[model samples]
Target chain A: MVVSVAHLGPPGTYAEAAALAYVNWLNQRGQQGLLCPCPSIAQTLRAAAQGQADVAVVPVENSVEGSVTTTLDTLWQLDKLQIQQAHVLPISHALLSRAETLEEIKTVYSHPQALAQCQGWLERFLPSVQLVPMNATTEALKYLGEDKTAAAIASSRAAQLYHLPILVCPINDYPDNYTRFWVLSLQPSGGGSHTSLAFSVPANVPGALVKPLEVFASRGINLSRIESRPTKRSLGDYLFFTDLEADAREASVQSALKELTAYTETLKIFGSYSIVSIGKL
Target chain B: MVVSVAHLGPPGTYAEAAALAYVNWLNQRGQQGLLCPCPSIAQTLRAAAQGQADVAVVPVENSVEGSVTTTLDTLWQLDKLQIQQAHVLPISHALLSRAETLEEIKTVYSHPQALAQCQGWLERFLPSVQLVPMNATTEALKYLGEDKTAAAIASSRAAQLYHLPILVCPINDYPDNYTRFWVLSLQPSGGGSHTSLAFSVPANVPGALVKPLEVFASRGINLSRIESRPTKRSLGDYLFFTDLEADAREASVQSALKELTAYTETLKIFGSYSIVSIGKL
Candidate 1:
């Protein structure tokens, strides 16, 4: 089967790198595929849900940045799309510049996420420099080619794509910066045994969270994540997003989900997909 | 006693709004005052630890977004700074423009966080327009004065500061959008009766999380937030950031912290402060 992957932005984003990695993985296994790029996570999920793409790859969380709200919110909102597999990509930032020397660099450019990730490094290395922020790291790279004094904090791959030289590599404050991405698709393939769901509990109820969680604990289903986002309609009301080891189709998981619905004001099963192993970089 | 409050930007940002709310609260109670505006969360905490600020206000989590990793990481890294009090400030976004009509809006500008928060509203309201992302919403508002077709997504206060007219108000997708901010001080006087800490567990150990969490459960300490950020050193290693009731000086909490240290690879207390009321706008 051909799998079409969707990612954020044009061609040189970290999302694109992840999508390419997934494509290469499929190709190495002798699987045929097409990787379709989308401008945003929402568009990518929409494409996958509408069968325009068989599977979509989007960033769900960042090790140094916590959860990507857009991805999580989209997963909660999109009823047809389900997470099939997850991948964690190690991220090493690079300072790219069109100019050859540090003396010539004046303005530094990058996506805010990239800029924030390398905050300490930038303060230490380029304290007096003018930091110019942009929409995407690729855009910064693109603009660097036009403005000689400008540098960009982007993936090393982005530097190469824009024909810019890396002034410094591994520029992030934390050496272990990584981004977690998830594969979303319409089909619930039970072969990949993982599921994600979103739900809300009644406000002011004591042990409201514990009761739903106990359902998973009793069933021996390992919960990978449990996060709460404010429901945004009232004070103290929260929507909980959770990841579990068993697929929603499994008897135990289904029973747990059913029991959870009784305790929760609202429950949504996002998707169930077999876990995908991240092959070597 | 004097309190030092820290926020995100120079003078304008949501963090500033929340900090001001905190300051107003202190003023109403006739407390001594100091406001420290740090460029980032790390700087804010550093100022607190270094005794530059009596207390600092930093964004920890948001209703739409889950957690701010910078705040979480700074808490993890800093040995002295602690969370004294937590407050939730309601966020209302506005579309500020120099031009009067939607037809004149050729570009929209905002901070990445603000832009992401208003994504659904922007897609629905201005689908055909170009998005001109900026470093801060205040910067966007500043630029709007120079460009006729540009509108900025920022707070009403920003519009007032920049002397721009509000074309639209409360444009966020979530009507109940709020941001959770923690006040950090070197000495724990104003924070009253709560403590926050960061802890890490051994890699590849199943149920390693349950033990420390059980301390809270067993003691009925009431956990407010629990977040996992990858260690980045190892593939599966993670650091958990949690907030619980009771000050560090409290017998039960101190005992739990002592018990928790034996069970985890690392345990650090961020701060203890009095809990603040979740403000209504």
Candidate 2:
């Protein structure tokens, strides 16, 4: 059976790279995988939730920029998608353009996150150049084809894929930039080391989050990450997303979540997922 | 003394509007306040921190998009700035262009947040239009002069300021969108009900956050918000930002903070601040 995987693209995007890596991982396990590209992360995830694809690969967090709120927010809204796997991709950005020198570049185009990651370099080199944010890194490649003064910050792979010359490489401000992607499927996967969940506490209560944290704490389960996103109802209301260093199927984790319901207004477990590092893939 | 307030701008940006509202608020209090427009939020906050401006006004949280990570991350990095006041401004986006109809718009430009907020409208009306993200919403104003096919999603005030035609009004998908701006000063302000703070705990500890949170819970201090940002060190490490529904000067808040220090590796109290509503200002 062919497994359809959806990701943000028009090709040469980091999400596409992640989807490719995941497909390789699946193929190694004796499963056929197909790729489907969507314009936005929301549409990519929706493809999985709506059953247009068997799985969706979306970025969850970046080392330098933190959580991808759109991913978390969209995941919260889509009820059926369960995380099947997490993949870590090391990010390296290159300036792709027809311009011979940085001084000749009039504008730089990239994904907002990539632009931000390369902010220090841009400020130092092309202080006055206009920075345009696009839907994806690859989206800027089409514009760079005819404009000699236009540059795009994207993966070196993108420069090769788009046949653009790399004027400069490793433009990201931080040397250790990485983004984590999640492979989400409609059905929950097998045993894994990490469990992701989100919950909202009853409003207007003191330490509404404490009881929920204590649920994991009392059981000696360590939380790998926690993020709070506004509920969109108002400023103060929030939905907390957390990652626990334990499997959802574990007796202790199940017991903790069962007890956690008493303290939360709403709760969702995004399934237990194991991490896969795409080293030099 | 003329109180110089720094904000992201190029006349008619929302930050400029917020700065104007703040200047008016100060004028009513019998103090002279001046506006200094910076090109970016980081520069605006830095101006306050470096004493280039007396205070800086920056968007902290938006009802639809949640916390602005740039504001929070920059605040966390700059320790000298303290919360002075928070102002909530209702956001209404208008499509500004020379084009007479939506079909004439071949491209759309706006700040990333504005573009995201008006995503639904743009998708419905100009599905094929290229959406270009600028640093500030008003930055797109200058580009609309010759490009009849380019429409910008910005404030109606921006259209008026730029002498551009309002092609459409209320372009944002959500009518109730509001952005909360923080007035940051070099010194702590007085008599505020809300206190903001950020802290990082020692890595690899189980329940590292629970004890610090218990301090507030035990003191009956309700938290208004909590957001976690990556430490930029690695994937799992994070720095947590929280808002407490109590004055930092209060005894309970002081005691809780004192105990919080024991559980945290580092903690910063970003002063206490009151809220002001900019009701159609």
Candidate 3:
């Protein structure tokens, strides 16, 4: 059986690399999978939701940059899609272009994150060049082949694949850049050993968040991470997303979940997933 | 007293608007203040740090978008500056250009947040147009005036200020979009009614964050907001920035701060500020 994976693409992106890594793990277990690239993270999730792909692997967090809000917001909007597994990838960006000199480059295109990561370098070297945003990092490389004056900030793999000159290597401000990606599927796998979930506290309650969080703390369940998004209804109201070390189906976690509802206005389990730590490439 | 306000600028951006609003408030209090337009938020903060400006007013959060991460990161890095006041301003983005129609807008320029907020509209109408990132939303207006085919997503004020045609009146996806800004000063204001601060919990301590949060909960102090940034020293380690309803000068809040240190490895008080709520314009 083939397990088709979807990710934001044109192939040499970090998202595509993550999908490949997940496919590689599946192959070790005697399963075969191929990647299907989509134009955006929204489209990548849609491919899985629409049954065009078995799962979609998309970056949800960056160590230096914090949460990938697009992926998080998309997952929150499409409530049914569940995280089947999570993966960590070390990231390094390269400046790719066909120009013989930096002076010849008039425009640089990349994902906003990439541009932000290398902003200092751009300011110092090409202060006047235009920085354009593309849907994805590797997708930005497409513009490089068409215009000699256009450059892209993407993975080293993109430079190799696209046959573009490596204008600069390791363009990111931080050498410790790493991103976490989640394998999302339409149907719950119901097997992984960890859980991802989101909840919103009762607005205006003094200890609204603390009560729901206590449910996990009392049970000795440690939380891996927590993120908050404004509720948009008012200034202080928010929706909290968290990842816990315990699975939703576990007896202890199950009881914690039951008590959690008393403090939270909304609770959603994005489902269980084992963490695959492939540290650095 | 001469109040110098620092903000990101080329004149027509929201940050400039924030600085102007702050200056206006100071004027109402029978004081004169001048706006100091900097090239970037980092520079704006630097202007205050070096005493070139009396204070810096920068966006901290948006209603639709979560955090203004650049401002957050800059605040974390420059630990000396303290929040003197907080202000909320309703946001509305407009498409500015010399182009007669959307079809003629071959390139769209904006601050990344503006572009993201208008992503749906851009995708629906000008799917194939190039998106360029500028340092500020107002900074993008510079490109619009120079290139007739270039369009910018900025405040309606930019249209009048730059004499550019308004291609679209309200380009943002959400009409209720608003941004929260903080006035930063070198020393504590001592007058504001509330406080903003950041702390890092010791790694590997189970419920480390819970213990510190409980201090506020036990004191009945309401937290207005909380944001976490990866500590970068290790995995799952994060520095949490939080805004609470009590000031450091208050006896209850002072004791809570003392109790917080027991559960945290590093703590920094970003100082007290009063809340200023200015609803949609």
Query: Interface Cα RMSD per model, in Å?
Result: 3.3, 1.2, 1.9
**Which fraction of the native contacts appears in each prediction?**
0.25, 0.67, 0.39
For A177-266, candidate 1 gives per-residue lDDT tens digits of 778788777876544566888888764333556667778877788777666665656544568787777768789887888888788888
Residue A118, model 2: lDDT of: 89
The clash numbers for all candidates, in the given order, read: 18, 0, 0
- Give DockQ for candidates 1 onward, in order: 0.36, 0.72, 0.49
Error of 1 at A179 (Å): 2.9
Candidate 2: C-alpha lDDT: 0.90
Model 3 segments more than 4 A misplaced: A97-109, A119-134, A139-151, A279-281, B98-107, B123-132, B142-150, B279-281
Candidate 1: regions farther than 4 A off: A1-3, A28-31, A202-206, A212-221, A245-265, A270-281, B1-4, B29-34, B189-193, B245-255, B278-281
The CA lDDT of each predicted structure is: 0.76, 0.90, 0.84
The sequence of per-residue lDDT tens digits that candidate 3 reaches over residues A1-281 is: 99999998878999999999999999999999988998788889978988889999999988877888878777877788988888989888888988888899999998878887788789899899987766678777778765778899999988888888898888887788888899999887665767888988877656777887788998899888888887666556688888888878889998999999888888888998888988653
Please give, for residues B244-269, the per-residue lDDT of candidate 3 as tens digits.
88778889999999989899888998
Winning model by lDDT: 2
Determine the backbone clash count of candidate 2: 0
lDDT of model 3, residue A208: 70
RMSD of 3: 2.7
lDDT of 1 by residue, B41-128 (tens): 6787788778877777888877776677777777676777656677878888999887878888888888777888888888887998
TM-score of each: 0.89, 0.96, 0.92
Chain B TM-scores per candidate, in order, are: 0.90, 0.97, 0.94
